[model samples]
Target: MRFLIDFFPIALFVLAYKMADIYTATAVLMAATIVQTGLIYARDRKLQTLHKVTLLLVLVFGALTLFLQDERFIKWKPTVLYASMAIALAAALWIWKKNFLQILLGSQLNLPAPVWARLTIAWIAYFLFMAGINAYVAAYYSTEDWVNFKLWGYVFPVVFIVGQGLYIARFIKDDDDAVEKKP
Candidate 1:
């Protein structure tokens, strides 16, 4: 449900682009995203940083895409968004000496502070790489090709993150076992 809600606007944007009639798709994108935001707020009573950022970007970049009739702006949206996240994560580590990623997600999984720091840095790097890759594809690919990549690229990072989580979980399990056996 969460995944579907998150992706609903992007899907509408692509469909609207393909249809390419009266900017109907941008309308759909805006409507869906607004509703998504409302629903999230209703559920949580508070907005997350990511949600606010995504909404702002959608409005700014989506409007540019519609008004300018340039899909490049829309394509670059993901890149900018990812780049911002990467910068934020990096700043949290180097400047603040706090791991926002772990702060956000750590309660679900018990891990050492060092491990969280490492994971946070890895995620920051991943975001930077994703932004670069999005730029590369957006620059070189055809419209349809770029849209397909935007739709499909979502899965690649999820797969990588899950793989990393599984790898870490294995070590965590071993650590737990060792502690349990230590009397």
Candidate 2:
């Protein structure tokens, strides 16, 4: 369900592209994102920092794509999003002595701090790599190829993330003693 919510805008973008054009796809994506943002705000009764940032950039980039009629603007959106997240995680690791990813997901994870920190850094690096891949694909690929990448690349990472989550689950129980003894 959450995955569907996340993919909704991209699906709309593909549909709009097929039905009308890039501009139409951009517009449809913006509408879908706006609705998604609204739902997030309504459910939380306030905007999260990450959600606000993502919404702001998506709106800005979506409008730029519409205004300039340059498909590149829309294409760059994912790269920007991924890069920004990677940078944020890296900053948290270096500056705060806290693992932002663990903090964000800690309620459900019982991993030790050091393990969580390492996982956070790994995720940051992974995001950065994905951003680079997105840039390369968007810059060089044909429109159909880029769209296909968007549609298919998503599934691969999702599967990997889930697999990693399951792997981490095993470590969670193993770390329970360390977690409970923490000061």
Q: TM-score of each candidate? A: 0.85, 0.87
TM-score for candidate 1, residues paired by index: 0.85
Check candidate 1 and list the clashing pairs.
none
Provide the lDDT at 78 for model 2.
86
Candidate 2 local Cα displacement, residue 42, angstroms? 3.1
Please give, for residues 39-158, the per-residue lDDT of candidate 2 as tens digits.
877776887677777788888999999898888988998899889999888888998777887788789777788778778877887888889999999999988788778878887578
Per-residue lDDT tens digits for candidate 1, residues 20-133, read 732566667777888899999998898889999988887888799889887677778889999999999999899998899888887777788888888888889899999999
Error of 1 at 75 (Å): 1.4
- lDDT against the true structure, per candidate, is 0.82, 0.83
Q: After superposition, how far is residue 183 of candidate 2 from its true place, in Å?
A: 23
Give the number of the best model, judged by lDDT: 2
Superposed on all Cα atoms, the candidates' RMSDs to the truth, in angstroms, are 2.8, 3.5
